[model samples]
Target chain A: MEDNKIQEVKSPSLITTPSGGWGASVHVFAPATVANVVCGFDVLGFAVNEPGDEVIMRMTGKPGITISKITGDDGRLPLDPAKNTVSVSVQHYLQSVGRADVGLDIELHKKMPIGSGLGSSSASTVAGLFAIKTLLGDEADPAKLLPFAMKGEEMACGQGHADNVAPALLGGFVLIRSYEPLDVVRLPHPAGLWCAIVFPDVDVPTREARQIIRKNIQMKDAVTQWGNIAGLVSGLFMQDIDLIGRSMKDVLVEPVRSMLIPDFYKMREMAMGMGAVSFGISGSGPSVFAFTKDEETARLITQKLQQHLTGLKIGSNTYVSTINDAGPRVLG
Target chain B: MEDNKIQEVKSPSLITTPSGGWGASVHVFAPATVANVVCGFDVLGFAVNEPGDEVIMRMTGKPGITISKITGDDGRLPLDPAKNTVSVSVQHYLQSVGRADVGLDIELHKKMPIGSGLGSSSASTVAGLFAIKTLLGDEADPAKLLPFAMKGEEMACGQGHADNVAPALLGGFVLIRSYEPLDVVRLPHPAGLWCAIVFPDVDVPTREARQIIRKNIQMKDAVTQWGNIAGLVSGLFMQDIDLIGRSMKDVLVEPVRSMLIPDFYKMREMAMGMGAVSFGISGSGPSVFAFTKDEETARLITQKLQQHLTGLKIGSNTYVSTINDAGPRVLG
Candidate 1:
């Protein structure tokens, strides 16, 4: 394989080279992220170890861009460039960078389940935009690329929230200051920290979950929420594991959202009792996640949660994951 | 100076000796602290260098407590130990530890002006409790002592607020997570940080200030406040000074409180333009505090604020200070 030539051609459009083909192809994988990590609400998120999406982009001779392949979504994803989130994101980025005429064929692998509270859509969006940027060479920075990819997430969630996308794209615990100019800062992630995420066979529409919440909250509750967030942020900085556990509490969002999850209270208590430091609904959930210091505790808590749900006769899929450091990577 | 004799003074009650008595006496100074550093609302606070109070507790004759001398407040402070905030706090701590009947004579030297937005009452309470604890050979732990002192503040503010008291008791940047169990955490204070506190001649009584706030806040505003708080916490942890400045905004409280401070908008803008990392009303203000990177900037910002007020024909007093690491110490 030539160093500059496209490798592992999976898209039909790439077979015939375009007029401006740089003979280079790009593949990007963005890790799955867990948003609203318990008390973190809108400010906290971390990338997960497994279950991510991959996107490959190649300069092509096709009249217009096309998503030739999208596996793992049961053929539900759109192939036409304009109707797809990934394609739309890429288009936005290209236009921003003055490269709108660049033609490319893209392939997306939806490895994670959609609407799973695992930042599935964000992963795909990040993966697609990242791949296109890689193929276009280093013409854009991650900060510039983020808003474009986040627009894809906005399509899924109705509003663009970067709590999940930022971490998935940047590969660490990220704080999104604002989505306007897309201000984000990455904080340190402690080593050996693993999270146990349990996705029960239940679904809660994000819109419905958000609707149950009050449009206005008492000023007192707001104060409490900010206090918890402050503690959580400080906990991460000091590396005080116990403080981190204590700080992962949400008074504003979880009470309303938890009603949608089965045995939410019991599962959270069980997790904590079984050595999980903290537990909260993952994003706008039917899924819940908990943090543990070690794999043994993670496994123990996972088993405890599974046992609690046995009466419901529903199987729970559990994943014990370390923090994903490499958010997105190229795979040829 | 006998160790056993000091041990016998189990509570503040046992330190009834006058200031000139033969028994050893301890005078502790606790600096005034700015609580709720803007976005932190109820969670963040840092101790300031200037305008601190002195508490002088000494052994005396009778086994009954008396606030022997109150030099500040223009002789308005209650001389009765039972009525004073500091003495009551000491009493509470003693009772909590099952040593409530010790006698002492306490002399409070008020260094900071009351109602100056410098946590004058909290400093007095912390200094008194701390001095008595030290004189009795008790290990002074602010975390354990804050709730007791907070009760005294409740008498003054009509509520127990740890924003100021926590930092005054425990030096550095402190977070008040909860008041029920009095959970507080001391967050890291970045190096070379200095605060310039400007006290314009005005008074916004804490009680009246509390009345002006709306009981209900729009959920949108609450979320923005929490996001900013999270950013502020992340900035402090990552030592990203720029983010810290951006996050110090308080959309909920400052807008309402700023009305009470003369020329607040102009002062804040001047401070920020002058390179203040963060600026906000210092606790139910009439006083405003701004953070800078160095002593030079601190001095420059203070002078700038003074100049701004001069232009407005509003007299203002400003003090340049570093983060007070020693919260409360023996003055002698």
Candidate 2:
């Protein structure tokens, strides 16, 4: 009966095809993101060029959801669709877009390392949900689908935050205006800008890192933070690169979070001296990222960061990326 | 002797001519500014369209400085250039630009009322310095001129702050990045937005009002303040009106300062409910300003604020303004 049902729906558009067939399957890739870009704190994020996740979604001839493949993870992720981040994210998308009857077979390629401060789990969730929506013929808007993906990320990180998922799904620089009901604003990508991301071989789980932050901040520090964020946003809009560099200060979060990253302050100083426009800890960070004006500066800064990490007896990987304008896309 | 000195210099530039001379010294107008836009605390400011201070500079052949005329100030302002805000500002500018030998007959048209929480002193200083520079063939850049003008404001307010003065001089939404050396960033001004300024006939001196503020703020509150500022700046860059409204919360300064303004909370609620994007005490005030997307809404908000003040037995003057892009312009 399942074979007969598959034969009946032979269209290229995934939206019209029935859900009970393996033929209506597709792969998706979603880029990793940098959250809390300096002064932005909890509001701003952007997608990077490398170290992304791959998600394959196939419509199983079963009655419910299942996770068929989960390579690269240390055998910890669950196989049930309701328990796994990728499968659960797909389940959420199907439910939210009113396609609850669909049964999904999801295979997550966790290319980026976990606990890398590079939004690895968020990348997987965004890739899986986005692919499933496309396989269903793009029935949901990206903005509409983001909250569901963020929910799946919350299942992993134990908090609902869109700082990473918004950029991972939409690309470029994005501002999460509101978390309740999830509103996001995407700003124009400044031309001739590139980012150098350096991930050291150290693990700092988001939950453990977050636990170290003090519950309260001084009002004076907060004012300074707001001022910096205001300057940063205005700098981006004005395309004032110098102002952007000046405003990349984090008085509230970075001062506390930097204690967890070894040689963080030294690396930041070196990157700045090497002509980086700005430098900051990525996410909760064992990783760090620096922005520059051109490819030459970005390359120089990457080498500088890697050299410093090697001196500290830590292995490192570096990539130079322009702004990612294409967020999540079909693999074809 | 004054007439003889005036006749000695034949140049048309007022900055070059002696006081009581026939040569015209062109004075400029710099718009009044709204500082600390709600949640922005000490960081945000925007130039208003109407009700600006006028600087009248005439060349005096006299070897030293003299303020020849002071009108519209109810005879309260000093005629001596050494003691006056505008004159002191001019002297500071001349010293910074290495033009100390220049003699001037300066006049300040204090059109806007003092103690209005509308940056009256900063307007006067910016206008005076700007006019003097223009008269001297634009000898000083705004960046070099701001510190001097800011000093003039500090003379009146007891502290130097660029949140108002920078925007008043440059004419747009501005972010004060730092106080030392006065770093400023200009933000985009979305067209068609207007501000409604209501000045109740009550005096709250900047010195007295500042004393009421708490010296320390909680760290949690500070974090929320930065978050709101980030949201507001992002909203302005994206032109999201609703987001702008939501981000207009002040946890640090407003609660302390609002006690000086009678019916402050009522006035804010009335204006906000009437479609004002944001409303707050302009500086340290009995005066308050509300932002709106258009002139009509601004007018409506002005009326509502006026009505609220009237209910509290306070009389007020109201003005509507668009963003002033042309700041400190010389008038021949």
DockQ of each: 0.64, 0.45
Clashes of each: 13, 9
Q: Could you give candidate 1's per-residue lDDT for residues A1-332 as a string of tens digits?
A: 01111112122222223334664677778898888777666667889877789988887654357788999888777787777888888887766666666777888989877767888888999988778766655543454566777788777778888888888887878766654445676767568688998887787887788788889889988888777777777777767777778778788899989898999998988888888888998888887888899999998887778877877887777778888977888886
TM-scores for every candidate against the unseen true structure: 0.91, 0.89
- Docking quality tier of model 2: acceptable
Error of 2 at B67 (Å): 3.8
**How many angstroms is residue B69 displaced in model 1 relative to the true structure, after the best TM-score fit?**
1.9
lDDT (tens digit, per residue) of candidate 1 on B174-258 = 7787655456777666777889999887778989988898889988788778778877777776666777787777889999999
Cα lDDT tens digits for candidate 2, A1-332: 00100111122233555454455888899998999997777678899878899988888666467788998888867777778887777776666556677777788888887888889888999998788777776653466667677778789899877889989988888877555435577766578789999999787889998788777666667767778877777777767677778889998789888988888899888988988999999888988999999999888988988988888899987888998988988886
List candidate 1 stretches off by more than 4 Å: A1-24, A139-141, A307-310, B1-22, B307-315
Model 1 chain A weakest 10-residue run by lDDT: A1-10
